[model samples]
Target: MYVAVKGGERAIENAHDWLAEERRGPADIPELSVDQIKSQMTLAVNRVMAEGSLYDPDLAALAIKQARGDLIEAIFLIRAYRTTLPRIGHSRPVETDKMACDRRISATFKDAPGGQVLGPTFDYTHRLLDFKLAADGEVPEAATAAPLQGDMPRITEFLNRDGLIQTETPSDEPPRDMTRQPMEYPAGRPLRLQALTRGDEGFVLGMAYSTQRGYGRNHPFVGELRIGKVSVEMDIPELGFAVEIGEITLTECETVNQFHGSKTQPPQFTRGYGLVFGQTERKAISMALVDRALRWEELGEDNLGAPAQDEEFVLSHADNIQATGFLEHIKLPHYVDFQSELELVRKIRSEAQANTLKEAAE
Candidate 1:
């Protein structure tokens, strides 16, 4: 007695219209401009670009506006748009040593080179609401200082000189692109790092927290965290030299973990690394912790079967778009499935009642 619902197209159109209206809010209020979002909501735009795996700030801003401030939706829009663009030659890896740092800090040392600059951070800010911002939305300019000169050396380099940490040999092999190919188990470190960088911020943060709470404890110390701009370069075959293409803001994190050594090897402090687009310290630190957790096998530590240690689980469920789609699909029409279940239930009850009656009569 069931009839399939019709007029799906009309329903969808109406729903979209209503959504558009909701996005605009009242007519009296000025509609938020993409430029305004790009400037004021820089963090949101940064997150979209980072998770979207695209470095375009303008597109990220547009996506943010179109998504009605939903960061995940903005990331989805950016990701979708990224797939349509043609891929040219890849750029050479950026050099963090030459970064023009705006914010830099280290927990392991009180004073380091470049001198621990704290630029535009909310770490020490009072949590009270500012009514002045609500009325005029104007922020007063803060005092400035002279910029630091020369390349700031990494804290790990100091340890490296003394042979206090494991030496990592550079590999020239190109990394596997997860977008172009299906993800496989036992993924290389580069693939895992890429997955962690683009993974849902909250999901990655939670996983990192779990490790701190004894799930896969790695005893991490923030060796250094830096935010800065670096020039991107691409090698030109015709020119016979690499040329600077553009500059991008990036956040880099290096975590010093517990020492791991055995009878065959000398004891040395371990390291975990994270690098991502824009000034996102939380994601960067979380990424580093998770990276170290995943490196347990190679570091000669026990697997411990923790969630963060499980590469497949972490990478597969990290994408909010994929997770949200599968989760939200449950709301769709499932009339056929429900009908089948209903009939099965009725048949089972009827048989049970018939058996009871036959037993009584006998």
Candidate 2:
């Protein structure tokens, strides 16, 4: 009798205990509280907020701690948690032009109107590891200047003034919510951008790098990169007017890429855009590049058969939750399918051996 292994329950319990021990590390060491992760691991928390499509850094940090620093698992936790959150209401469209920017830069111009402010970036830092940080050392606060007032002008607006870039008028129409709906083929710009913002950073980076490596290469220049907070206003039906609900940090990148003119058209610049839910410059920039590459068809440019250029390819595979869930599910037992394959292989081999013996006898 072929008996299946027993004690599955006990095995699972022991495995869980081991996992919990591993997650907490040595008992002598101080336990990591969720608040500590939220404040100390700000960058990691920001990434979770961006990719999980939620703005709660606290929740993201908790998810991270719970997941034992497995970022995809953290994202999954946030996504699942977000699904249960009650829908209060939709907010008014955020005006990026009126953003209170902390970091704003443009690669297209040497000196833009507002001037570049490279705030709180690790870009200039050497890659050397700091031994002091091993003991959780604190950095001294730098001198701060008073907040700049008045609205910051968009870099794209300047190009539009000169008739250099394609001019786009603002629409009063409401944009579709991608999370609430299943994505269909031939998605609009809003839908595409939403997918890219919450996309896996590595996948986005690879796609962007592919474009630079001659696959759908469209000479790109960073038109603008801005990190700032914008008010999320919600309309109160009883009050009859929209009021400030809350605010969220965002990173917006706009890329100006070369656009070829058709026989009857004049050459003009087209745009690739990205907007993420935190200060993530690299992800935002990569997202813009991939966005531009995917716009080849819309801008009347040739499709160079790049992975990034394929809208369906990029949007469909970008999310971490979808990718990880499908991948890790394979670890679950599929003995029935394996048994079928096992029987088929044995039968085929046996039949081949028998045919060989028959030929030898003849």
Candidate 3:
């Protein structure tokens, strides 16, 4: 390792200046505003928020812009900024049953209580690009519908009524935040969920795919997936009560899995849950599959030695920021490490040559 940075101070400053110049691009082209990224490039902003463990779309958009659309770098920026913020208070658990749903669907039931609002989605849309969008003319407005009059019952609640699925009792205890403390092995469901929610979407998706491919088979079906806005509330000591602060978009997924019954309990369909910061259905689904895989021990199912079933391995490597750090560090000066390797190689070669000479004489 070098005593300082391999690049001198002037070279580093010059490189940063060059980077800024490159980030700006052509002088003729207009610079992208943060609002454009927030509103138009919405999915990218959502991903940054979800993976970065921060709920600010505007900030995520800014980070995206600053990082020149490199999502992982944007996440790193957000995480660094998040660590500097003061810990005032934590929000109460959001109630998904009461969400103002934008998109809602159920795979288990054709007609749920909510009646399957398609909302704005890519599911039914043809992949063919529309040239009209490039022309920048006024787009046709979407049709509006009246909001549901009453509370739309959750799909799982229906199965729960008949005791067809395992029951998850609500607890008054607060969920442990993984950020507050070091991650300990054999982490609880709360910690695992926290990690999965903020974990890299690709890594989680791969693990989920492995499970589906029979690596750690747990027959999984999407019971319901919903995307919507939920109110965030926090209690203030001075106010003496919880007050609604703001609303944030969220995606929730519940998977119904194969029945796991034991001598003490009757056969019941199992449950796997996923909740993320935004409308990231893929990540939510992947999180649920991996979540189910981790529940093998709790469900009395044998571990199949799959990566998904191994909580420590999955959780530890799922963070892209951490993975990138280890990967990129090798690009730095490795003179000390390389010099030792070079010396060992030289010594081995010299010894081999001496042996060869002695053999020739014999």
Candidate 4:
């Protein structure tokens, strides 16, 4: 992975120096702190954490500061840092149904079980910029309400009761860990979900959007989309039981698709799931759509020959870090490669002229 340049050390060092200066900006204005970024620029931090496959807000904020607000660069830094940390033990699967939901909405149903909680959404707001922030950073306090009460059962469960949607077949086999092992295809749904959750948001969103635009159409309705904090539990060897390690905010999405009938099974609704870290509703919803699209074969649905349906294509290119790394390598000095190409072109041109002159003489 190391590319050595003969006399580029001083140039590289100077570039680093200039980068640091640019990151700090003007000396007159007060410098921003990691804490301020951690607290204030919450969505950006969450995105870094999600894409970086790390959950530390402080680290994400620090990376953002170091990258000068370039989120992809921040993600690259976080991913590199994560490689140095030692692995402990795997945590139990998060139960999102028990989540302390900050926002929950369903497009398919009029009112879901727990009712619609529109917590802190920009859905109804006008897109025009609120110039009040340019003058001063003050705002009115938000109204508070009592905690949401009731069992947060999944909307798919209702369809499942009527045998309208496919039921999940329980498995004792441990799902593959893509982070621990090298990615191999054809990957199962579990492995694909792993990649999708940590995949680049923009790419996944675009792929999902393409599906809506008639490529591998899945007539998906938002069964439910909820964002909130859920407790993370880990099984302790010493304690011989699982303990609540901490709480993590997450976004879970479920999409309901049109009914389909096959040779063995009757016509039933299909469901798509997306469970991701932080309150990334857009990514979560996109993930659900793509996840369903990828399940064409498993669901006994016909392959519509769409990009989203191709697991290898989607999973391989979804990582922004890998993509950026490969693309950025071209920026490095390629003098020798260029010189070889230049010589080849010159030789080809010279041979062509010689042949043309010989033909003219004849």
> What does candidate 1's lDDT look like per residue over 182-289, in tens digits?
899899899999899999999999999999998995789999999888899999999999999999999999998876675444688888889989989999999999
lDDT of 1: 0.89
Candidate order (lDDT):
3, 1, 4, 2
RMSD of each predicted structure: 1.8, 2.0, 2.4, 2.8
By summed lDDT, which 10 consecutive residues of candidate 2 come out lowest? 1-10
**Residue 33's lDDT in candidate 1:** 91
Report, for every candidate in turn, its global Cα lDDT versus the true structure. Answer: 0.89, 0.86, 0.89, 0.89
Clashing pairs in 3: none
Question: Where is model 4 more than 4 Å wrong at Cα?
Answer: 1-7, 146-150
What tens digits encode model 3's per-residue C-alpha lDDT throughout 219-292? Answer: 89899998888889998889899999999999999999886586545799888899999889999999999999
lDDT of 1 at 306: 96
- TM-score of each candidate? 0.95, 0.94, 0.94, 0.96
Ranking by TM-score: 4, 1, 2, 3
Rate residue 134 of model 1 by lDDT: 79
Worst 10 residues of 1 by lDDT: 144-153
